[model samples]
Target: MGKVMLARRAAIAALLAMRRDDLFVVTGLGSTTWDVASLGESERDFYLWGAMGGAAMIGLGLALAQPRRRILVVTGDGEMLMGLGSLATIGIQRPKNLAIVVFDNGVYGETGMQPSHTQAGVDLLAVAAACGIGARLDVSDAQELHALAERLAHFGETLFARVHIAADDPPRVLPTRDGVALKRRFRRAIGIAS
Candidate 1:
């Protein structure tokens, strides 16, 4: 598997092991990478449309409402940079249940090969820390990443993880469901309709 795929899988495995029914997963383009790693049944995985950074904001809402539940957000590096401000909101609230995993490909692969904030020295882990969230970086092999994921999972603090994945294109997966449909299903699963 590709580096991004490996990282996503490792992250998802860590998440699944911590399975809590109340937890929701807010994800974007790269979520499929993690989904492939997730076993059997999956949680509410929000497939972001063209909107970037949307997953993080949505995750914030879920975390706030269900303080006892964990909220895992799977997002791309480019997407997270788009709404870095949301980190501040999450930090101020100090929600212990929010965990954000950013698959940093160093480029906006989903929208063509454009450079990402990480390519420009935007240290996302540091940015998240500055925004008041506990953060860390994992750039080694899959084993190391899995270890880091374990450390972050039950930290009981808003955590941001920057995973340096090899920059590459993902295998084209068919969009079985559009954004609207996915949103509706996700909302129903999370007991939130809009």
Candidate 2:
């Protein structure tokens, strides 16, 4: 209820630390991608360089394709808002292995920190619930982050969480920009035999 919020980098670090080794990650364009790559680039990570609103859908496809592995989509509030319809589609498909986490700093970090829909008082958790997502988690602090991390490690159903973070710009950590190499690496990581 106050101005205090989680640090974006720290939140990503904590969540990734709790993530299971095989949990496939699909990061939205911009900040979230840098946040995850800041930790360390991984072949399991399919970082979206330009798909502004396709992270959740990609996660859904991955979940459906690999039912045995977990899929986590780490995206920003701006990207999530752009891909709002994907939530409904995900709900319809109901991939039990997929989870979406929105880092809500309340602004478009990729652009110029302009206020986003979430900053305009949109309740993303409610949106996800109304869209038929099975689990809704609102995380703002350390305890809640821990709880969410635990659930992510052993998730049993479709999950959507909004993590409130500070709208501060940390130094960007750029990863490989070669989409072709990234695609090949990710495919090999998932054992596509190519």
| Model number with the top lDDT | 2
Hey, what RMSD does candidate 2 come out at?
A: 0.9
lDDT of 1 by residue, 1-194 (tens): 24334444544565456555666777765544335334543436665555666778888887888787778787888888888888888778878888887877678876677887788888888888888775555544666676655655565777777767666554554443466776677778877657
Name model 1 segments beyond 4 Å from true: 1-22, 30-43, 135-139, 151-153, 191-194
Cα lDDT, all candidates:
0.68, 0.92
* Model 2 TM: 0.98
- Per-residue C-alpha lDDT of model 2 across residues 140-173, encoded as one tens digit per residue: 9988998998999999899999999999899999
Q: Enumerate clash totals for all models, in the order shown.
A: 0, 0
State TM-scores per candidate. 0.78, 0.98
Q: Which ten residues in a row have the lowest lDDT in candidate 1?
A: 32-41
| lDDT at 126, model 2 | 90
Total residue pair clashes for candidate 2? 0
- Supply the global lDDT for candidate 2: 0.92
lDDT accuracy of residue 82 in candidate 2: 92
